[model samples]
Target: MVRLEKDLLGEREVPATVYYGIHTMRALENFPLTEYKVSPVLIKAIALIKKTAAEVNFELGYLTKEKGQAIAQAADEILNGQWQDQFVVDALQGGAGTSTNMNVNEVLANRAIELLGGQKGNYSLVHPLNDVNMHQSTNDVYPTALRIAAIWLLKPLSEGCAALQEALQAKEAAFAGVIKVGRTEMQDAVPIMLGQEFSAYAGAIARDRWRLHKVEERLRQAALGGTAIGTGINANKKYIFMVNDRVRQYAGIGLARAENMIDVIQNADVFVEVSGLLKALAVNLGKISHDLRLLSSGPRAGLRELRLPERQAGSSIMPGKVNPIIPEAVNQTAFHIMASDMAITMAAQSGQLELNAFMPLIAHHLLGSLKILTNAVHILDEFCVQGLTADEEHCRNLLENSQVSVTALVPHIGYDLASKVARRASEENITIRAAALALAVLPAEKLDAILDPRAMTRPGIAGTPK
Candidate 1:
């Protein structure tokens, strides 16, 4: 069965059982863009905002005790994951999330009415705009909700990064004694411990974790009470003070009201800053994945220093082929994250005077990026990083064959003589040790001690034979 609901734009037939009413119905007709609905995290954030507003308005006597209690209870139910499907608006809607705000308001109002022994859409008993929304505006509530949602999403992303870091650190410890030839510009450069390479990956992820925490700190400052234009117009002063406190209590996060509400409302640079950090993390993950792909390139033809876990078949026709699918998947996720950052940047900069009309887009991309990145990091840790194995013999063979091992002899034989040794090794297609021996640069025992790949990976210059 359907019920008729009306507004200034006229009436529309909505399904009678839906908690959302006419406004959401109009939005559903309006923005038929992506099939993607608004994030449940965001919906919960908005519910918390509404719940907090109800509690605050009730405390200040702006709402009748019964109505406020009912509204708060309805919002709490939504927060606890009830009737999420009633929020039917597209994630990409216009009107600066007014559609989203209205969706939340309508759902809460109807649910509240139900609790009070009235039918849904009976706005006469408990209005969506009057009782449920109370003193809130989309301008303030929407952005505040976005901030809360971002913080909620970032916590897991941060934990995912830390877990990935720990996995890399474990690899670092496992590979500590494995010496390998390090490369620069895709050419062998010097000897380095395989552990050092993994350690650097761990350090990069550690920094990403730290940066995400910093971004969370900025996101925790919200603009909830600055209704419409940051002046808290049409809202009670006491309501403004107590609303954020109540929201903080409900969210269990360290959310505070923005000091300069106008700045928070007008500028979306905080999200831009967050996108930048996420992009940085994407770049780091991409680089690490690329290195993994290169190091684990081939079992027979390429730099087979590391063996990635064989997760799947590489080709349809090949009988026994396994590709580095995990790292490649991470690389693609990084690409999407970087592109989302660009979208977020454009949306953030496109904000006009007092309020950004592009908040829906911002919220969509920001939360989307965080969610994808968190999943990507977890996949990379579990599928790739944790299962990686170093080819100890391959590493030793590469170190033995590389002319760059002459780099360790530089201080002992002087730069000029080391250059001769490197040139002669390349010319004769011989190992640096063989070239040094043919040139009679040092006795065999001395050459053996000096050209040790393990010793070369450690600190301090080569000491003269004692």
Candidate 2:
């Protein structure tokens, strides 16, 4: 079944059973880029805006009550997850998301026509542009919807970060007494408790979670009511003033209309700022994952100080080989997020005057980064960080073998003597403590006092490391 629809360009045939109409049909034929569809969260955000606009227009006497009710109902159905497959426009499209906006507009209009006992493509009954998309433009509506969708995704990412932080903090507490050698530039440097190392991860994740929440405030400013080029062209002043508040009320979000709508619509720096924060998170997660991989390298030959949960086999032919698969997965996810940040940065920088034509690119990378980072954090918490076990005996053996722990006595025995002891131990194939004893650098009791894990892991080493 085909229905005839006409636009300024000409006429096209649309499937009669589909809610989406001619604009979407044209877009489907035009854009055959990435197969990814528009994000459902973004679609829902647009529906929230449409429903709010309909109710506001009806109450303001711009729309007839029946058409308004029918349009609102259609939007509500979309909001409730109906007709999702009808939004067939490629996420990567031209016209600065006009195709996506028109896609939504057409679907809602056709569905509303059905509700009002009119057939699809009956513009006289419920016009897609005249009634459903009244007082909105792709310039204003797309960016506003992007912000709402970004905020909604950010909440879960923040929560996922919080969960990761808590998991790391738990490890910090669990391993507070587990002694280990710290490294700098991939070389053993000094003594540190496992807890202190985990504490650093916890601190970084805590900051990431807080930053995600703070960045949400930046996304709260919406370009809605700004219309085409931010001058609210062809839209009534009453609608311009009332629409944002209604959107906020209906969406239960703290979205506020920008004071300088023109500037807001023109500038794409907000996405760059948000992407920078997400990149920061990626950096930290990458660092932590790298550390996990290093520490859990081998049960027999590698550092073997920290043990990750037994997951999959490391090789197809290897026997009883358990790899740090979860952290490896997290590392890949962080890498992708970092690359996404770069893409988002470039797209944001490429914005021209009046509007950014690269928003689809930014939206794809930004939203994708948010979702993948959230999943990475959650998996790191549940699958890796929580199941981590410290190889205390292995840690102790490494600490005993490395001369780095000798640096703890530099305050009393001096650096020159410590170096001599380290060299003597290396040359003689003996422990630093034994070399120190043979050199008579200090009494055995005094050497043991400084070498104690508690004393070695703290500042101003001495009794109880206070």
Root-mean-square deviation per candidate: 1.6, 1.4
Q: Which residue pairs clash within candidate 2? A: none
Candidate with top lDDT is 1
Candidate 2, position 219, lDDT: 91
**Tens digits of lDDT, candidate 2, 376-418:** 9888999999999999988888887888868776787898998
Tens digits of per-residue lDDT for model 1 on 64-83?
89898998899889888989
| Best-matching candidate per TM-score | 2
lDDT of each: 0.91, 0.89
Per-structure clash totals for the candidates: 0, 0
Misplaced by over 4 Å in model 1 are 464-466
